[model samples]
Target: MERKKNISMAVIRRLPKYNRYLKELLRTDVDRISSKELGERIGFTASQIRQDLNCFGDFGQQGYGYNVKELLNEINGILGLAKEYKMIIIGAGNIGQAIANYTNFERLAFNLAGIFDVNPKLIGLKIRDVEVKDIDELAGFLKATPIDIGVICVSENSAQTVCDMMVSNGVKGIWNFAPVDLEVPKEIIVENVHLSESLLTLSCLMNDRTYS
Candidate 1:
């Protein structure tokens, strides 16, 4: 089924959870599951699941429900995970190095093309076989090798400067971890991962919870 345009961001966000749960079903050798059952496992209402999937396309059958493997493949296609994405990391700090070390990045087809940092100590250090390079070399590296995604893990002060370098060098996607909103061309896509904000969200949820 073809993905429909203008799908709500809320629906788009739920797709990954569906994908993850479907993969788990595959691992368990579950061949098929009704929307009710799948929703039970995922903690969503069956009708909500049906509505979300319908936004993408017509899926499943009247009675037999969804085929686990086939649905997963379809969702993967929708999420643009079928191809490889060449990525570079800037900062090489704790957050940067942790991202570089994560095996799931490669598993998810995000290839770490290079890592860069300004500190002399981190330059030449290797993480997951990719040696850290001087930040000065970023422009040339981006020129030589086309990078699809640029990771910004530098401090807020340095984040915009690093983002500008990446954007000017033809990098289209930015995975920004630095705590600042970046200005980019309309065509450029930026996904921010603010650690502090996420932690605070958890705290807020905890505080808002009422005793049952």
Candidate 2:
């Protein structure tokens, strides 16, 4: 299927939620579902669901709705879950170790290639089968391995340096757990998981009393 360009980030963001919901439906042996049913589950209106889906190619039929498994497969392809990605973590700290320990990423085709750290205590630690190596080895490792994603679990001061090294070594994707926003080239895709910011968002919501 041909993908259209200029798709808004809002729509792109919603695709993951749809992907998750569809996976749940598939696991429960759901065959098909209309937009209204899906919207109700997702708290979106039926028309809103249709509009968001229409950003991609035609998915549901006029009356048949969507074929659950097929829709999921298509969404998976859209989210690049169909391909295998080699990932390396720079910083074997709490966030990095937690990411390494998450087994689901491997199932989603995100294979952890290596882990690096500046601290001597953490340098030799093994999260799973991947041993944490010295941060000094990062440059050579990146040159040797064509990593698809570089995870930045280092501090704000070191995050940009790590990102630069990864970008220079053919790593276009970055999953950053650092608090600071990283500066990268236009081609580089950085997805940040700022823990403090997320918590602050929750705090704001609670104070506002607007959570539904």
Q: Estimate each model's TM-score.
A: 0.97, 0.96
Q: Which is the leading candidate under lDDT?
A: 1
Clash pairs (backbone) in predicted model 1: none
RMSD of each: 1.2, 1.6
- Tens digits of per-residue lDDT for model 1 on 26-91? 999999999999999999999999999999898899899999999999999998899999999998
Model 1, residue 106: displacement in angstroms? 0.7
Q: 80-113 in candidate 2: lDDT tens per residue?
A: 9988999999999888999999999999999999
Could you tell me the lDDT of residue 145 within candidate 2?
87
Model 2 superposed RMSD (Cα): 1.6
Candidate number with greatest TM-score = 1
